[model samples]
Target: MANPDECDTMIVGLGAMGSAALHHLASRGVKVLGVDRFVTPHIHGSTHGRTRIIREAYYEHPCYVPIVQRAYELWAALEKEIGERLFVQTGGLMIGPPEGELFAGALRSATEHGLAHTILEPAEVQARFPGFRVPRGSLALHEPRAGLLLPERCVEAHLALARRAGATIRTGITVTGWTADDGVRIATDAGELRARTLILAAGPWLPALVPDLDLPLNVERQLFHWFEPASHPEWYDAAHSPISLIEYADARFFATFPDVGHGVKAGIHHEGAVIDIDAPRAPASAAEGVEMQALLARYLPQAAGRIVDRATCVYTNTPDHDFLLDRHPAHPNVIIASPCSGHGFKFASAIGEILADLATTGETSFDLGPFAISRFQAPAT
Candidate 1:
């Protein structure tokens, strides 16, 4: 007789990735169980900023283009399946010096993939978009297929669909520990649960769950600020303004979103204080607000207005800023996925399918070389 608590697969952390995994597995008729320390679609994790950019011409790497393309299809399918709007096509602009990594890399990816894009001079950018004040030497790469994804709604839709497909979801319960000696035994704050396979997608809390691996993961404290438009509010409208990233200096970037009822959202990327996962998050300070406002004042002067609201979030970063997705070295039944390095929310839909494939069939059609954990492992002694 099968134990009532036993499931085909058990997943810890029902954030963007885990929730999508649950939906995929359940749709395939797998008896899956998902647990999260907080409620789904909550503000505690990385998926609650209201909007996340989804772009086809990935400046980070050309390899991501295919996966992100697939992600676009999957996100649209999910929207149709659930009957809710999850994405918005506002287009996007990657602005930087011609020789800089942001513009050059985006151009390379667009050229390589044959994506529809146009290279614009500073004058062209300023003329076409009144919201931006691009520097004289900088250029813009405009891609039409880039826009925002409603992250909280996506999570809710995925979890709701998973539940409708017979998956068991437990929230407000933390997974304290797990062992894989005989099947996978998950020790949670609520109680103990067993499953044939275990997946660890706990985001910042992932390190605590797999301490033995000594994984190279760092949690960084990040801030998101929304500000009221100082002038020309029409320039910050969804139809007129495009999501944009400016590489102000070498390897330094910040992003902005059009005011979607709340306020104009903006934040610096990849440069935040290193923090422990368990430490209390400090609120965004006034000095930090000044710093961001200074940037906006120089680039998009109208956006540097009164601060309406601010929120804090953490990024689980790997040393190289790549994702970690692989099975445990010693335990084949266990899979590890997290440390997205702050730029992974857009790809959650495709990654969830990849995780489902890894958990069930132990393989996927997508290339996992760049995301493998072995790159961080030491040479055999």
Candidate 2:
């Protein structure tokens, strides 16, 4: 942040949204300065997981379907621009009881969107995939166009392209505070910078930056464990295996990825310790390891070899598990987005465009009403 007042757009947190916003804004010929406390792709936030799930038929809500649709386009365009593979099409399976959230959500979204999906019985799933064994009453909705997103690479590609497109990306600097007087003035440890607009995609740090907003963003420390496949590593490779989400019990779900560089990354998405982003992640516990062991032994028996590695990431979640993307109710020049509610990485590219659009034109073509701040607005005393 050389000159706080000199920037046309100062974007904080360059991991996913910030990087995307910088690239999009730079491409649109905006003088933008993208700042991050740590250099993005640096494994300090939620976006550092080696891979993130990217399912098209969003069971969380139908509103997310279109956002993901645009995200797919942006990711494809990004892959073309960077010449690096970001998404892998390994059909996705969401398994649960027919009336469970996983099943009902998938069914609702699939029916609403007319997506190509098939509901299969537990035995049918086992017979077809041969890689999975579900409980007797469980079923699966198969979405063919779903897979994983390489998180670090995606961020790197976005930032690299943004720099090439003339966006100044600064890292190793922390924004102490900011204000929107006329445009926006940001005070960082590095220096002061100014922008016509500001975007707060600061993930876990959102509440810290805008304490007045009283945002209900809880940063949970989530873990991903990888294991060497006991059998059929080839089929478990990126080519053959499908990314899986299994809901064995009520509100208990875990997502799994195929063998990437390390091994098979599997973890429970919503279950983890609530963390403050600045603090180090809580150490993995023996009890948690035992739980994962039981989970794998039952849900994913074939590849239950041994735990090879584990890593932690953050999940900034809203109360309803939806995203929060809206301009400041008080400061028009400031746009606040805390969308990565464990499901946001896939939408980063499009979110970058959405942020860029909101910053530049005050609106976007994508329907973001579901993420509006009014949903979290306070009640009168």
Task: Compute each candidate's TM-score over C-alphas.
Answer: 0.97, 0.97
Residue 37, model 2: lDDT of 84
lDDT of each: 0.89, 0.85
Q: Model 2, range 149-215, lDDT digits (tens) per residue?
A: 9988998999999889888877888888888878788888877777889999888888888877888
Q: What are the per-model C-alpha RMSD values against the true structure?
A: 1.4, 1.5
For residue 304, model 1's alpha carbon misses the true position, in angstroms, by 1.9
The collision pairs in model 1 are: none
Q: Which lDDT tens digits does candidate 1 get at residues 167-286? A: 998888999888897589889888899998899999988989998889989998888999898999889877888999999998899999888878889999978999876767889999
For model 2, the stretches where C-alpha displacement exceeds 4 angstroms are 1-5
lDDT of 1: 0.89
Clashing pairs in 2: 3-193, 4-192, 4-193, 4-194, 5-194
Decoy 1 TM-score against native: 0.97
Q: Which residue runs of candidate 1 sit more than 4 Å off their true CA positions?
A: 1-4
